[model samples]
Structure formats: structure tokens, C-alpha cells
Target: MAKFFQKNKTIHDENKLEIVSDKSPFAYVEAYKTLRTNMNFLSRNSQYKKLLLTSSIPGEGKSSVSINLARVLAENGKRVLLIDCDMRKPMLHRYLRAQRFRSRGLSTVLSGNSTLEESIATFSDLQFDLMTAGPIPPNPTELLASAEMGNLLELLETRYDYIICDTPPVSLVTDAAILSEYCDGVLLVVRQKYATFQQVKRAKQNLQNVHAQILGCVLNQYDVSKNVRESAGSAYYHYQYGDTKLASDGMMQ
Candidate 1:
């Protein structure tokens, strides 16, 4: 398991979203570099490459995290494929600016309306392939849990070194927990001031109930200045692995 904190100040602009790249802020880039290193260590130790990222609720930034994580991994020369598994609310295309292929993606492939190769969109700028959520489906849960979805993943694993799936919030629906069965690990994204402690706890419990391998949690949109002001002394956060206790404030101890 791996645990890390990321603080991003970039505001989401629907017309032009920002992702990690050479032109990004130094601190933002370095944070994702650290995340990449941590995930690499976990991958080597656990022998898993398929990772699923979900949050306790909407607006937690899991999709953005997934996109940047895949971008960083691809920057390291790995063959990465980022999939938009949130069929009900697909936004990867919009984030990556590949909305042109929004109509033909994972849903179309799983439903036999399109082939995987035909649905995949390649972003030359990002250097990784993307499979959008496709057109919104009536039964997203069923489509994700279908045998075809499993087979598609199996085929993709053979082609790519890493597969990052962005799923819906765990607390809002069972989609994340259900898709966890096909993934090797799960990363929970928690927005600092937005998501409640109880909501996070319930999300973790939901994944655990499905026996999902929780790689770790990412604290998103963390405000370093606010924490420094509140603590009056320390500006750093800490986390402990295995047997770690969750403090009442929802921090790992």
C-alpha cells in the first residue's frame, strides 16, 4: 500500500481544463512525480498494474487525479491506457479535450457497437491512449460489470503496461465497488474541505466490503496555508502504513 498527499490549486475550467505537463507549475509537477514514484514502488511490491481511482463523492477530483497519474506514468515511458469508467458521468474526454470521440468509447465497445481499437482516442499531446465513457448508458452498472468488460480489460492488459480507470464515487453508487473486482487496486480520493469524514469512512467500508485492495487514499485540494495557520507550528501531514489508526479527524495515524 502507498499513501501520499497532493495539493492542487488549479481551478477547473470546463472550457480549458489544466493537466500535469511540462508547462505546469513546479510544485504541481513535483507532487505528481512523487505520486508516480510511490505508485511505482507499490506496483513492484504488489505486482499489480491495473489501478482504479474513485472518491467518496462527486467534486472530489478523482478524474483529474486519474488523468494526471496516467500522464506522469506515460511520461516515464510506460504504455498507459486511461479509461473513463464512469459511464453515468463521463468527463475524461472533456478534461483531456478529446470530446470528439465522446460518442464512441467504453460503452460502445462493451455493448458490441464498436471495437476497442476503434473507440480508443489517442492524444498526441498527452502521449497516452484514452477510452472515454462513450455515450451515457441507461444501465451503467450492468455494462461495467459485464463479462465483455472483463474481457476487454484482459485484452488491454496485454497491450498496455498500465491501465488507469476513473470510476464514479463509491458512496454514491456501487459502480466503483463492482469494478474493483476487475482491478488490482483502488485509490480513494478525498477532497479536504468538501467530503465529510463520515462519507469517507463509508466509502472505505464499501470498497472493503467488496474485498477490494485499497492501495491508499489521496487527499486532494489540500490547503497548506490553512493547515499551517490551524496547527500554528507544523505545516506537514503524516501517514502510517499497516495497522494504521484513523484519527477522529479522519487522518491516518
Candidate 2:
């Protein structure tokens, strides 16, 4: 069974508590912190603080990375707000084990059903905030692409240090590409052994077509044993877009 995430016995859902502060071992804690550190250099200006995290396809651990990154940021004393923009398949609420699910999220705020204050749920203990997917709506794409979404993001930048959003897959839906317009940059999460280079390349092109800034990529669940021995101790190819190349063990470097 996978360690980071597993299916819950009763809920039949998969949610992992691999956060650094409350749980996680030394390497996991240090890994998320290092990811936070690299992200710190993204921008000195808080105005440009929105970072959208997405993946090429489902089951690639984008939501996992987003929540973990948010936790690490909050641990560093930053007021982080993680919004589950993947209204179709919201998992942030599941990850937090929220008591219930209702119209208390981006959808409600976008549709004027509720105020932003009411939509946001504060993780009192975790020190970060979360905006769930709210009630599943029929027109998810329209709501995500509307001017209301842009306005909400702009308003959030004033209140949160970082607005990290977990969105739907780029190839699967237009939501990720559409939401990318409001974000400062987009981070692609690629699960090693699952996502192919071509799929990630297409995802990047999709983001680029939308004019979203490419922050880099996060290679998750990367096992170095097989490839490491094969390469005889060589640096992993972290990211290769066109001519640019930057490699790290796991976090975006």
C-alpha cells in the first residue's frame, strides 16, 4: 500500500496527514520545509502571491502537495489560504477531515450565495485557512472562469500571504488553465512512474497557452532505488522545458 495516502476504511476515501508540524518523520518534514524555502524566492511582493498547483491527470497527488505546502507555509508564520478550486472533485476538505460539506466555499462566494468570510474555514490548530469546493454546481467551468473568480483571488491576496489553490487536471478540464490566469505562477505535480514526460509537456503547453507563469514542477513519489542504481549515482532530471533544466531530489529547485 502507498504510505502517504490510503483509502479510509469507513469513508472509502483517501486522505493522508503527512503534514510536517503535527506528523511526518524527519525527511518528510525537511522535504516540505525545503519546498517552502524554494517557494519563498518566488516573489518578494505579496501582491503576486497566488500559486496554483495542478497535475497532468488525476491521482497524481496535486491536492496532497498543495495542502502540505500550505501547512509548511503556515508553520513558518505565514497566513496561507488553500482553496480547493477543483470543485468537481474536491479533496482538500477530505484531507482536513472537515465535519461536513456544504455551500461554504469558492462556488458560494462566486455565485454570491455566501460571503468570503463565511466561505473560508480556518484550521485553528494548523494555523492555515481552507476554502472548500462548496456544493457541487452544474457549471463548474463557468464559475471558475468568471470575473468573480478573478475578483475573489485579488481580494484574497490582500488577506493571505499565499493563495495556494489545488485545481483539476489541465488535460482533463479547462478549469486549471482558466484559473491559472489569476495565479502568479503554476506548479505542475508529476508522480514518478505514473506520469509520462509527454503528458507533462502537454500540460505545460496548456498552461503556457493561457499565459500562466511556469514556476516549475514537483516530482512526487520518486523512487531512486531502481533509477539510481541504473544511473550509477547521477543527478535526476528534475524538469526539462525547452532548454531550461533544474533538478532537485523532490521539491521544486
Candidate 3:
């Protein structure tokens, strides 16, 4: 069985910022192989030049996962763009402390109130571009379902090696599901213990009903101890099966 990782949540002094520099031994490398494997799989199959990272409900850590995954992909030499598509309550900008970019983003561009070039904001230091949700619109879902929204993603696909969108939770609103069809693939983030199996199953079905290609799931905030025990059980089950099969063959001989 593959070993599970032990990660302790860091307590940063009031700044409320998560310092996840690649220098931290566990920051990028420990999770690099796992993230890279997922990225490679998406890159090869699904024709997924663009991806949407969303959850069944809020507080599932979809934004953080999208950011880290984009960073990992950039580290692997892929040109990645992470867009904040949660207009109702935009937090990606706050997460990264990027305030200037939010003024002109997806809502601005999609509403025909701003040009695509004017709407996008780049972070050269991060090596990944970001498009914020922009000024909260009166109707976010309707705007996202519009043709302009589709054109914008198509335009981004031509410009970036990988386009990752951090959208609003599907179960909370239909925004994510509406945007799912526009994306090349959808990656669902399931919160450990918080997100129920039924919630994930329903989210998958929702994506399927929309004909969105679900890339798979990323189980966030997973407990290392519990996962290890579960993995050990699976290994034991497989080992027992193998031994029984071998014994049966020997008896037949």
C-alpha cells in the first residue's frame, strides 16, 4: 500500500496568510509527485486544456487546491492560469493578497464592460495569471451561462497551457454546473469527513448530466492516520486474495 502523508496545520501569527513556499520540504515536493500525476493524467486524456476546480459546497478548500495545483504545474514548466470564478463571494484575491486585479476580471470581461486584455491580471512572481470575479454582478449565474462566458474561456484556452478555474460550489448554486460545460474537464474537491459520499455522488451525477468530463476527486483535509489504516485494510484484503488463489492452484495440481 502507498504511504499516506502526515501534515499538521500551521499556526501563522495573525497575518492569516499560509506560507507555502516550495522551499518547505513538504510544500511542493512531498505533494509534487501526487499533483503532477494528476496533472499529467488530465493533460493526456480529456483534451483538457482548461479545468474547473469546484466542490459540492463551500469551505471545501477548492480555491487552495486550485492554487497549489496551478503552482505545481507551473513548476513543471507548464504555463498555467488560475481564475477566480466565484463572483458572489470572491476570496482568491484575499487568499493571495492580490487586491489590484479584482477590479477588472471575469465579470467585467463577460459583461462586455471590459476587454479581455484589460480584465486579466498577471502575477509575474507567481508565474501564473489570475482573473478575479470582478465587481459582484446582480446576476452571476446568468452571466456565466451566456455566450460571452464561453468565448472568454475559449480565448484563454488559446493563450494558456493550462487554464484552471476556481468556481463556486455546485450544491450551493448552479454556477459551477453551468460553467462545467464550458470547461475541458471538472475536478471535484471533496472535504474530508465534511463532505458526505452522497454529496460527492450527487455532484458527479450533476456534472455527468451536463456532459462535463469529471477528471476525478481530490480528497482535501484527509486525516493521515485514518487513511493509512484504510489503505492497510485494502492491502490485507488483496494479500489474502492472492494467497487463497495460490493455495487453490496448488491444491488443483
Reference-based lDDT, each prediction: 0.76, 0.73, 0.67
Ten-residue region with minimum lDDT total, candidate 2 = 229-238
Indicate the residue-level lDDT of 27 in model 3: 24
Writing each residue's lDDT as its tens digit, candidate 3 over 1-253 gives 0111213222132224232344433422445358667678867865788889888766566776776677667767788888888888787776556566677888988888888777766655556777878898999999989998898889888888999999877877888899988998888977667667898888888888888888778766555655432211100000011123110000000
The local distance difference test score of model 1 is 0.76
By lDDT, the best candidate is 1
**Per-model TM against the reference:** 0.83, 0.82, 0.79
Model 2's lDDT to the true fold? Answer: 0.73
lDDT, residue 80, model 1: 91
Residues 2-91, model 1: lDDT tens digits? 111223323244423446755565666766788899989987888678899998877666776787789889989988999999887677
Q: What are the per-model numbers of colliding residue pairs?
A: 0, 0, 0
Q: Which predicted model would earn the best TM-score?
A: 1
Better of 2 and 3 by TM-score: 2
Worst 10 residues of 1 by lDDT: 231-240
**Candidate 1, superposed: residue stretches over 4 Å from native:** 1-16, 226-253
The number of clashing residue pairs in model 1 is: 0
Q: Which structure is stronger by lDDT: 1 or 3? A: 1
